[model samples]
Structure formats: C-alpha cells, structure tokens
Target: MTGRIVRWGAVLGLGSVWWWAVLRLVLAPDAGALEGAVAAGGWGLSLLPVHCAPKSRAGARGVARWRHAWRSAATKASPRPRSDGGSGPS
Candidate 1:
C-alpha cells in the first residue's frame, strides 16, 4: 500500500514538473538558459526512480517471496475458528 502511494506520488510529481516547464517555455519564448537547464534537470531527476528499480530476475523472485511471506504471516495472526462452533461465550 505504501509502495503504491510512493510510486503514484513520483508519477504525479514528474507530470507536474513537465507541465510547468512546457507552460513556462510556451508562455515566455525569451526564457533564459537557467530555466531550460532546470527543466532538463527535472526530467533527468524524474527518471531516477525508474533507473533505480530492481532489474534482475532474482530481485523479482525476492519481491514475490516477500509478498507471500507477508500474506502467510497475516493469516497466521488472524482469529481462529472455535472448536465447538459456538458464537456466544461458554
């Protein structure tokens, strides 16, 4: 859940940066070099997350194992069924 939130946040941030850059350039044709450089830097920084993601097959397997372990642990910690199948207190 947290991972999904972070990934979505990154996507939104990247979109915002690009949108701002485009609007600035379009609205002001006389934009300076610093502005252009900042926009370019924003684009490069936005791609860092993608570049940092795990690329190996082992990494994929590790993620799967982690998910499975988490699920199993959650299930194990849940309430169990009553042996007598009674709903009220004895």
Candidate 2:
C-alpha cells in the first residue's frame, strides 16, 4: 500500500513539473527552469531505475525519490482524496 502511494505520488509530481514547464514555455520564459526540471527528473529517475523488484540500493533510492517528488506535488493542503465520482444521481 505504501509503495502504491509512492508510485502515484512520483508520477503526479513529474506531471506537475511538466505542467509548469508547459506554462513557462507558453509565457516565453527562460528555458533554464524547464531544462532544469527535465534534467533533474531524468537524472533522478535514472538513479534508482525501478524494475520488477527493487533489489538494488539504487532502485530503492530511486523509488523513494520518486515517491517524495510525487507527494510534494500532491495536495498537502487537503490530504483527503476528493470524491468527484459524478454530480448526477442514479
């Protein structure tokens, strides 16, 4: 369960970074920030490099980093998962 949480967290974090990069791109901002995020994410992702099983230390580290990154992007303001199932009733 913990691992699952981390997995989703990392993906969301990376997605957030990508979204920010897109915004920057649209604003005609400096490429530095976008480039930095890409570079850092690439490096971070590569460092541990998840596999079928996190046997190696590097893989474990990578998983941990990924989870941290994801959690950071998540709504710390509201940790609870919002129920947006639908507005209509059956």
For lDDT, the strongest prediction is 1
**What is the C-alpha lDDT profile of model 1 across 1-90, one tens digit per residue?**
999999999989977867777678778888777667768887787677554555584365577788999999998886889898878876
What value does the lDDT take at residue 67 in candidate 1? 95
lDDT agreement with native, every candidate: 0.77, 0.70
**CA displacement after TM-score superposition, residue 87 of candidate 2 (Å):** 66
Clash count for each candidate, listed in order shown: 0, 1
Per-model TM-score versus the true fold: 0.40, 0.35
State how far residue 1 of model 2 sits from its true place (Å).
0.3
TM-score between model 2 and native: 0.35
Over all chains combined, what TM-score does candidate 1 have? Answer: 0.40
lDDT of 2 by residue, 1-90 (tens): 999999999989977776676566566556676566675665676678455664574355577788997888784665655597555676
- Listed per candidate, the RMSD to the true structure in angstroms reads 12.5, 20.0
After superposition, which runs of candidate 2 have C-alpha atoms over 4 Å from their true positions?
Answer: 31-33, 36-90
